[model samples]
Target: MNYETFAPHPNLDAIVKCHWILEVPGDMEAPKQRVIPDGCIEMCFILGDDVKRFNSENEFIIQPRAMVFGQITKPYFVKPTGYVNTFAVRFYPYGFANFITQPIHELADKETPLTSLFEESSIKELEQKIIEAASTKSRIAIIESFLLSRLTDKSIIDNIVTSTIDSLSQTKGSASINSILKDDLSKRRNLERKFSKQVGISPKQLGRIIRLQAALKMMLNKPGENLTQVAYENEYYDQAHFTKDFKEFTGVNPKQYLDNDQMMLSSLIYSKD
Candidate 1:
């Protein structure tokens, strides 16, 4: 398995987080990998064989070849059908809304093909370019060109949403909406409405995901760190509180996360982030 991320173009640095690529050999026996919410949206192009997202023990669906997967609230499982080669754009929590008119909340917890969001002809052309690009660098150039063309003054994300996200991120998701808004109840209500539409999840949900991500980084990087220390460092109420939230999102506690073979993919991705 090989996974890597690249910086976005300077002009798109604010909204676009990074462009990533992943490749795994076809001959390897791949297991069902668990994917958890990371408080972000992704636009992906599957450049190799198909992938399956499981809905239940016996049910699964093939992910779109060129698609935008919305904000995920909980963990899900995916397995490669064969070789895995994918190129994707990781957008900030509020970033994807700046390029589409659809209500972002409507896209949560599932993958929507690009044709549904943009013109069919244009999407086809863009997907072709990405698939045929000679290298990852060329693919990044193609996607950036498409994104820059779609971006417009009217599509700019709301300032309140961006600033609030900044505050949450800076505090590692510990900051409350009231504190960020200086206890302005009216503004809190307004922000909640816009945040759901623009980010596909509530402010509090995103905060929790962000905080979980911080804890995950620590656990993966510092293998010797205990749960109690990890919880305190990330501002969880206590180890029990931390374990509850961890299980909610990951379907497993921190100790299991480190030892679970199924977490191989998620661990690789989170460690890099």
Candidate 2:
């Protein structure tokens, strides 16, 4: 398995987290990869065989070759049918909302085909262009052009939502939303409404996911650290609280997550910038 991420053009830095590519060698077995919530959204294009997204213990459907994966609250599994080559655009919590007209919350926890989000003819044209691109650089250019063209009103970003998320991220989700908005208590309801519309999740939910990512990064980077210490450093109330949240989003205990093959993909992605 190979994964790499590239920074977006300077003008899009605030809107796009990064552009990434993943490939699973045809000669190797394609293992089921578990993906957890990270308070972001993604637009993915599969350039190889179709992948399966599990909806239940024994049920799944082939994911569309071109689709958008919305804000996920729980962990999910995906496995390639064969060789896998994919190019994806990852957007920050409030980034993708600028490109679409609907309330972002409506897209949570599911994959929506690109045709549903854009004109069918345009989506079809974009997919063909991406597939025909001769190199990764060409693909990146194609995707950026499409995104630039679809960009909606950039003024839609709310200052409250932006500052709240910045605080949550800076503190690694340790900052309480109330404290972040203590200056104007009356704006809490407005904050919730803005977050739901632009971030696709409540501020609290996004904070939890961001906090989990912080913990995961610590665990991955410092393999020698113990869970008790990890929980303390990350500001969890206790070891149990940390473990419970870890399991809730990752579908496994911290101990099992260490060096677990199923978690390799997610671990690699998080371990890097």
Candidate 3:
């Protein structure tokens, strides 16, 4: 397996986290990979083969060739049909709102085909251009051009939402919403409304996911660290609290996650970012 990420164009840096590519050798057996919540949305294009997203223990549907995967609150399983090759855009929690009309919260835990979001004709054309691109660099250029052209007039991000997200991110999701808004407690409900539309998840939920992400990073980067240490560093109340949240989002306990095949894709994406 080969996974890599590239910085987005300077102009897109604020909205886009990075562009990434994943490739698995055709001869190797690809394992079912678990994708966990990370408080972001993704726009992906499959260039090699179709992938399956499991909806139940045995049931799953093929993911669209060009699709936008909205904010996911639960972990889901995906496996390659054959060799895996994909190019994807990782957008900030509020970044994708600038390109669409629908309330982002409505898109939670769903994968919408690109055609549904954009004009069918344009999406078909964009897919062709991306598939025909000569290299990864060319593919990134194609996507950047497409995003730039579709940029919406709707504000890219709400100022309140941005500030709340900034605080959560800065504290690795350990920030208290009450404390963050101590100056004006009355706006709590208002913040929730904004989060629903712009962030696709409530402020508290996003913070939990962000904090879990921080702990996941610690586990990935410091293999020798124990749960107690990881939890303390991330500000979790205790090892039990950390373990519960970890399993809530990842569907597995910390020990099982440490050296598991199921976490390979997610680990690569998170550890690097």
Candidate 4:
């Protein structure tokens, strides 16, 4: 397996997180990989063979060749059908909304094909260019051009939303919404409404996801560190609190995460982040 991430163009720095590529050999046998939420959205182009996202023990759906995977609240599993070659754009928590008119919340927890979100002709052309690009640099250039063309207004993101996200990120999701708002607790309801439309999840949910990401990185980097220490460093209430949140998002405890074969892909990605 090979995975790499490239920084986005300076013009797209605010909205686009990075462009990533993943490749796995077709002949290599692999288990179903668990994909946990990381508080962001992605637009992906599958340029190799098909991939399956399992909905049940034996049931699955083939992911679209070109699609937008929205903010997922829980974990899911995907396995390659053959060779895996994909190019994807990872967006900030509130960034994807500026380019589309559809309510972002409506796309949560599922893969919506690009055809359903953009003009069919244009999406087809963009997907073709991404698939045919000769190198990762060329692909980045192609996607940056596509995203810039669609980004009509750079300031479409609500200030309140971005400020709250900035706080959550800086604190590694340890800060509460109330503390962030200070005396303006009355705005909580309004913030939730805006979050649903622009961020695809409530502020609280995004915070938890962000915190989990921090913990995961720590675990991957410091394999010798204990879970209790990891929890303390990340501001979890206790080992129990950390375990509960980890299980909620990853379907496994932190100890199990280190030993689980299924977490290889997730571990690799988070380690890089």
Compose the digit string of candidate 4's lDDT tens values, residues 1-273: 999999999989999899999999999888999999999999999999999999988999999999999999999999999999999999998989998998899999999999999999999999989888999999999989999888888777999999999999999999999999895979999999999989999999999999999999999998889889999999999999999999999999998889999999999999997
Runs of candidate 4 exceeding 4 Å displacement: none
Stretches of model 1 off by over 4 angstroms after superposition: none
Q: What is candidate 4's CA lDDT for residue 182?
A: 92
Model 4 local distance difference test score: 0.94
The whole-model lDDT of each prediction reads 0.93, 0.92, 0.92, 0.94
Candidate 3 residue-wise lDDT, 1-273, digit = tens: 899999999888889999999999778785789999999999999999889999998999999999999999999999998889999999999999889889999889989999999899999999999999999999999999999888756465878889999999999999999988876879999999989988899999999999999999999888889789999999999999999999999999999987789888899889988
Residue pair clashes in candidate 1: none
lDDT of candidate 1 over 177-255, digit per residue (tens):
8899998888988888998889999999999999999999999999989889999999999999999999999999889
lDDT winner among the candidates?
4
Tell me the tens digit of each residue's lDDT in model 2 across 53-131. Answer: 9988779999999999999999999888888899999999999998889999999999999999999999999999999
Query: Which 10-residue span in candidate 2 carries the lowest summed lDDT?
Result: 24-33
The local distance difference test score of model 1 is 0.93
lDDT-better candidate, 1 vs 2: 1
The TM-score between candidate 2 and the true structure equals 0.97
